[model samples]
Target: MKDGKRFPVVEENYRFECTLCGNCCTGDQRVWLNPADLMRMALFLGYGHTSELFRQNVVLLDEGENGAWRPRILFKSYKKLRFCPFLENHLDDRGRITGLCRLHPKYKPLICRLAPLGRVWDAETGSEQWLFVKPAPDCPGVNSSRLNSLRETLQQYGSEIEEETAFLKKLQHFLEMKSEPEAYQELFYFIVKRKGEGDKR
Candidate 1:
């Protein structure tokens, strides 16, 4: 095979113009939700600024320590497939995939908001690598000639860089708390409650 390794996530840059075909939102992929995402989505869905309702009904917390990161809060993939529950399929006369993600910019999760672009985090160095990937094999966004700045494009998406940084700081503090096993569950609830408190105000 030819050496088509492409570039590192950080150096990756490509043109993309999302057609909102919903292909990316449909599949067995992980949609990780951070505190910010939870809070924003709750508020968007009129959950009264607190994620309690949303958490109870919409999200799942992955506490397994088997991966690079520990204690992840994520959206419940629709049914058994990776289809996002929030994805709304638009159809034409005969009914076919036309558009998706009904809650696009406003209530979209952080991951969904950053679709077609990929990111990798370095825990040790506290750095992130960026990659511009095709949202799907048939995604027309990747083939467009229009070019966009990664930084600028992120800004256009209403990037949560600042909030993500703050969340990491909170995560650090939570890690430092290092609760005993008996209290770990409580700690999770506490974090959730605390994270949503700000939006309550």
Candidate 2:
């Protein structure tokens, strides 16, 4: 429970399997990225700097909540289409236009790796709970015969998820201590310097 309210928590036996229909890649869904994500993407693309990543593929989203506004980093969709920039569409054997992500299976953002499931953690209590990210009505990956445990899903990222989670907790704490503008600048430089120091793992 958070703020004296209970949230629906997903169980361990939650089952899901991606059919790779590409529905998730076609929407205006925002895939927020952490510093770790930036590092991975930079390493994958062989870029020494992240400025081009922002200029080409990512954007600073002006997110607001409860009269508070902050700049969060997330991927940008194509200018003409409301789909991921990396998303490719091609006709399958069945004559269906299937969506394929160039960065899938590896180099994907953490949220993309944990699609259909989202986590909420309390900074004070250090407790985390998983919730179902509402999928599209016709999404075929919701409940399939192939079962996947929540632990297994998270384990797909191995130790990276743990590191990302820890970093997020610390970042959240830092944000609360500083003003929005200060926090944004600090966060940007921290990510650049932290990743620039050969922290790619």
Candidate 3:
């Protein structure tokens, strides 16, 4: 009795309880920050407005086709690779990651909230889909007996999930229409370069 048009039967067996292992936080994947996230994070950090905090802590990704700026967390690296500045690999005396995000519980990115659920879009039909990311074979959370019902899981984080789905759909559509990776790269570079040039003058 499920609606096939909007709700396809997706596998919902996997359940997760975050051990705060921080594996996913240490990558170069795009970390999108929406307005709501920014506001909440700023408030949690006692900032009157998030604009300055966002600008200081985040970098703008390439502008979308609609010319809106997309923001992502920025990091400095010894090499050319990017990472999250808030991620730490070592534990402190108290056994917590030192110099890492103290506000992780409140300021995690929307994508971080939807971890283990990779969103993809079908280019031909423009439909969104979700797939589970099986944890590393050694992860302890994988063996937990607690399970979250599909409705409960969806309700807990639906807005962010929907936003991610929409973003993936748009990205997939663009990729399907684009001729080559270089073409998309050039487009992104052109947009970013133009903005930089404008700032210099």
Q: Which candidate leads in lDDT?
A: 2
Q: By TM-score, rank the candidates, best first.
A: 2, 1, 3
TM-score of 2: 0.77
**Candidate 2 lDDT, 113-200, residue by residue in tens:** 8877777766678887787664555788876887768877777765877876777666666557655554554444333343337664
Candidate 1: clashing pairs of residues: 9-130
Give me the runs in candidate 3 sitting further than 4 Å from their true place: 1-10, 63-69, 78-82, 88-101, 121-127, 134-146, 159-201
**Model 3 C-alpha RMSD to native:** 9.2
Clashing pairs in 2: none
Predict model 2's lDDT versus the native. 0.65
TM-score of each: 0.67, 0.77, 0.54
Candidate 3 global lDDT: 0.54
lDDT of 3 by residue, 22-70 (tens): 5455545566565455555565556554555545665455544443445
* Candidate 2 Cα errors over 4 Å, as ranges: 1-8, 64-80, 135-137, 189-201
Per residue, candidate 1 scores C-alpha lDDT tens digits across 20-137 of: 6777766645666666676666665666534364355565555433222323334355457666667777776767667677566776777666766766555457777676656666
Top-TM-score structure, candidate number = 2
Count of residue pairs whose backbone atoms collide, per candidate: 1, 0, 0
